[model samples]
Target chain A: MLRRKQFWFAIMAILPTFAIFGWVRLFPIIETLRLSMHEWNLLSKNKPFVGFQNFIELFSDNQFMDALTNTAVIAFGAMAVTIPMSMVLAAIIYHRTRSRFSGFYETAVFIPHVVSLVPAAMAWKWIFDAKLGPLNAIIMGLGGDALPWLFDPVLSVICIIFLVSWQTLGYGVLIYLVGFRNLPKSVFEAAQLDGANGFQSFLYMSVPLLKPITLYVSVVTLISGFNVYAQAYVLASDTQGAPGRQVRVLVLDMLENSFQNFRVGYAAAEAVILLSIVLLLTMIQFGLLRGKGGR
Target chain B: MSAKARARRTNFLLDVTLFVICILLLTPLILLIANGFKTPQEMLVWPPTLFPKDPTLENFHKVFTETPLLQWMLNSFLFALLSTVAIVATSALAGYIVGKFPFRAINIIFILFLATAIIPFEVYMIPLYFQVKALGLLNSVGGLLVGYLVMSFGIFLIRQNVIASIPDELLEAARIDGAGELWIFWYVVLPLLRGPLAALAVLAFFQAWTAFAWPIIVMTRKKSFTIEVGLANFQSAYTVDLSLLSAASAAVMVPSVLAFVLLRRNFVEGIAASGMKE
Candidate 1:
């Protein structure tokens, strides 16, 4: 009787959380899947089921294609920059744990992670400004031409990639540092005994040993990179328009389709694509981590 | 040189390199703060000064007097504080039960909760917007919070913390001593769950505080905007007012930056733990 009562109590306890989770998160996801197949505007009473018509239209749509391509490039680009840089930085920090400035170093690196995104992006936008920004000023001082950071088509995407990597680098470092701490000391000691140097041990052992951490960090960085919106939005959002290119990204495209353009179903299709990419990456991450652990 | 001296010299070189890297890493942030105090005229000066040529608080003054910044900050605070409370409460209650209980379906429920973390907010945010709108919550603070009230990550983190920290024997003893389940939970478990709960609360608050995308969609009216959304809108309105923009961004950033610095441990541990478990 007591056990049964406790079980009921447990159910009641979790009921609200499950309900909120299902309604707020799970239900919307399922509805987005269903909505992807149908055509509906915000005002329409009926959503006409159009099968894969929206998906087919999206493939042909220049804007959607551009957005998809930009988002992919940004995601992969950020992941590439973030993983190697953060790992090396984390290794540096991890080894210097005895230093008093270690805490300062960690906090300094991690501040960007916690700093509000819009402002951070804004700050970077200022830094990347072509004429008046310091970045170009320094480049010119170094005798390089002051390349347009936010205006040029290619440079604009690179700017976004830089911004995305900047925000994610701190997070990747923090996680990698944790992975470093958790790594066994004996392995490193053995490596030293075998006459392997610090860099070599790090190259041979730490890199491979930290595969799961790398996978986790890359997955996180890539997912957030794919979800890139506000960074691009804030960077190129100058209204008086002194040469800023509004780089089309997936979330921005979906928002435009949904709110600005009022193609709910079409946006839903884009959402589905974004969903598939994220879920696919997450599955791969879990699979890789599981494979490593199982071994 | 002696081997120890050589080692010391290398350590000093490494420290210098790390310092340079940290400065580079923090340059944008440094620029945000330094430029916040610059006059508009000074901002456009050639050889853009790192420290304001003549620092002034006029931009900050103008932001408060000229814009709905105070209202937006209030909105942001309400959203962050209320949502933090909601997430912590819901996550704790559910985490405790799911973490401690041995009910037949509990494992599946726990897995389901964890699984939701994999679904990026971008995937479901559209339908969530529609749902919020359908409920007549558009342009309201309540609508802004509907999406943030429960974080799947918090559920997982709190559950892990609970399982690791709280033993079953304490709860079983409380139950045997004729304590009601609710009372035992309130008295026994909550105190023990304080450390993780605090971490979850801080993380949730930071997430809500820095939230942009959802708030921008939900709170369209200037008066209804959170600080982040307001700051963005402020930028468009004052296109050339770079100083004012920097000041506004600085104001928005300071609290979060301060909080992170103060609660550095919780933030780091929370992020690290989340990364490890995932």
Candidate 2:
């Protein structure tokens, strides 16, 4: 390799990468931002500039609000439970379990991590099925009523969260388990020497030590949770289905408006907002975590 | 002596209980695997049985015969194969650049790419679909590959692994030794990165292979349909063949499962190696 040519070679190595990123990631995002300003539907004769009206229309839409609220409830509601439990389970496997059972347990739990959203949703939907599902069977087995799972909007959302949590718990365990392993053994040992036994050792030493893992889990889970579409789509049918697509998440709505309805400009505006939220939340998450010696 | 014996027995019992919990975690799939061989009628027939009596091969045959499951499987392999290749190559290059040769914009780009991990594919599908359509990339397998690669968490993940594992001194020594950048990357860095890169490859393959949302939005027809997308189409009033659908699902799932198990060690090591972003 020529010495001066080496620099070009280094640059050349990354050129294909930049080309792909620019075309697929960069261009779409920029195009979406630009498309938000123009009303160009597939059926329309003359394309015209719409300025900020798409944004205005999106915020005012009732369906948009419903989707937003549903999305938040699922994301936050699921994470609130999962993060704490993951910490506790991770702690048990890390601190309490001395034998190789932890490895067995970790792998078993993480198997669901490898399973995708679509099949898992189908299975969970079966579990939550009203007529023939096992959930109802178990409920009835316990002398309870068989309830409408998907039909009831609230129950459906909760069930979806359950599915999300199940699908994600393995990842949470894997990541947190690693974090637990990385924790300073001396800190816990010192706490033990201080007679901080059992619960105290966990409370005083383990929890604080796993703060980094907790923060990481929160941001990652939040991101994954926000992007949840496959479960909703798989369970609810392609775009939006009968019973008014009650479980329609924001992404679904964005899909319907932009692609199905040919509201490209409006959909582009929604995309921009959605991306902005994801980006902003990510920054905020980093900021919040980074505050107390954030990683 | 009696008290000590009791304590030992209790400890043994507790270990068994822990094993039971592990079994419960895997029970769903164990149930599915047992039932994947059953007729739809037999599967529905419940005293809620665990094992199918006949354990027929009919469902598997229905899977292959009625559905384009084999085709979808081929597409899935292609999708996973091509995307993994792209991610490993691009990410290794990009990671090498940002890892060595510190630039002023590196930190900002690092954060930008990291932030991309947050903006899920759903957010991009509509815009991306139109982008594909406008660029004349509709119903194209290669186009899907590009869309998948753009979400470069694999790069960011690999870079983190590279940074954590490889020392800057190695690069410095190589530079002094007149080993060029390409040579350094190919021989030194890539070898060290094998662990994380393999792990990320498994992950990247899974994500692309199981991808449903973008495939739904971008690929308008069956020609470019991936396994997951095609498997989903059965339930969409397109077909009511539940048995065939499940068969297709198992087909999509088996390769991923195998990849996961085969690469299991690396996956754990990779995630463990990176620690966490928090």
Candidate 3:
């Protein structure tokens, strides 16, 4: 009876957390899946069940396809540049510096990560603002014509990618620095005895050994990239992914459908799709990590 | 040249390069702060001066007097404080039971927590909004707080920390001394969990502080707006007031940035732990 009581007590201890998760998180997720199959706006009295119609419309819809592609481009594009650049930066800071200023370097790089995204986006918007913006002023001073940073379709996408990379680069560098710090010093010493130059050793040994950290960073970045909303929303001035929807990521697209257009069913379908992609990437990350014998 | 001389030259070059990169990375932030002090006329100058020609405190004064900046800051603080405390308390209790206790349903419960961490907010955002609205939480701070309370990440973080740090022998000794489970948990486990709990608090506080999308959906009233949402509205409302916008952004960013600088080590460790661990 005492043992049974202990078990019940343990269950009771954890029940509040489970209740919160079930009601707020798990139930909403399941409800999202359910809502994806029905046609219901916020004002609608009746949610008519329309099986697979929303999902079917998603593929045929041009805006959804654009948002999907934009998400991929931004996520993949940002990660591609951010991972390698951060690795190189981390290597420089970790391998080269033996002074006290290294701490300053890490903190400087990390400031962006700690700041709120909305403010950072506001700062970026100011930097990218035309006419009276500082960036264009510099270009005009240099005798170059003022280029549209956020107004052009291609440039808007580039600006979004740049903003994401700028915010995330510091995080990548810090993680890679941890990875570098954890590496065995003896291996580098041995490599030095073999006459391996700094460049050669870094290219062959440091890069390969840091594969797990790289994959981990890439996956985290990838997930955040797909969920990119606030930055685009803040920077674009027009929240509907301005410049002909060139930078409209999945989240923004879903928001527009649900709140602006009142297509809650269609937005739920978009949400379900994003959820699948996130789950798939998560699975791939686990598989890769497990193949490397687990962290 | 001698090997030592060559090495010295290389190190000097690397230092210069890293210094330049640091400056470049910090320039935008520096500009943000610098422009906050400039007058509106100075902000409009072509090939804008790096330093304000005439720096003034009027913009900051105007932001406080003209806008609901303080109320928004208080709202943000309340949200962050309540969310952090709740997350730390619930995560510690649930994590202790899940991490230390050997119960039959523990694995399923732990898995459920981990599963929620993988699903990004965007995925269930619409449904969550509707759910909160149905509960009459829309446009209310309590409603805003409810969504943040389901912190699976915090639970996992605390659970991992407990499993790794706390020893079973200690709990066993307490049990042998006739200490009740709740008593042992209160006096022993909670005290030992101070380090991880502090780290989790920093993480949760920052997460709640910087939250944008959810607060935008729920906090429709001006009085209920968090600092971040208020900053966004301030931008749209005063589009031509560059000085005011810069000042507002700086004001909104100060708290989180200050917290990070103060708890630098814990913030980095917590962030690294979240990413590196499964």
lDDT of 1: 0.88
Residue A122 error, candidate 3, Å: 1.5
Candidate no. 3 TM-score:
0.96
The alpha-carbon deviation from the true structure for residue A109 of candidate 2, after best TM-score superposition, in angstroms, is 0.5
As for lDDT, the candidate ahead, 1 or 3, is 1
Task: List interface RMSDs for the candidates, in order.
Answer: 1.5, 3.2, 2.4
lDDT of 1 by residue, A179-274 (tens): 899899999999899999778999999999888889988888888999998888888755354323589999989998999889999999999999
Q: Which whole-number lDDT from 0 to 100 does residue A43 have in model 1?
A: 94
**If scored against the real structure, what TM-score would every candidate get?**
0.97, 0.90, 0.96
Native A-B interface contacts kept, per candidate: 0.80, 0.43, 0.71
lDDT digits (tens) for residues A45-134 of candidate 3: 999999999999999999899889988999998999899989999999996658668888888889888889888988888788876678
DockQ result, candidate 3: 0.65
Clashing pairs in 3: none
Best by lDDT: 1
Model 2 chain B lowest lDDT segment of ten: B237-246
State which candidate, 1 or 2, has the greater DockQ: 1
Candidate 2 TM-score, C-alpha based: 0.90
How do the residues B1-278 of candidate 3 rate in per-residue lDDT, one tens digit apiece?
A: 99999998988888888889988887887888888999999987887777898889999899899999999999999999999988988899998888977777977898888878889987887898988898898987788898788588788888888889889899878888999999988999999888878888988899999898889888989889999888887766666688898888887777667778889888888888876574
CAPRI docking class of candidate 1: medium
Candidate 1 lDDT over residue span B151-231, tens digit each: 888888878888898888988888889999999889998999888888888899999998888998888887898998888
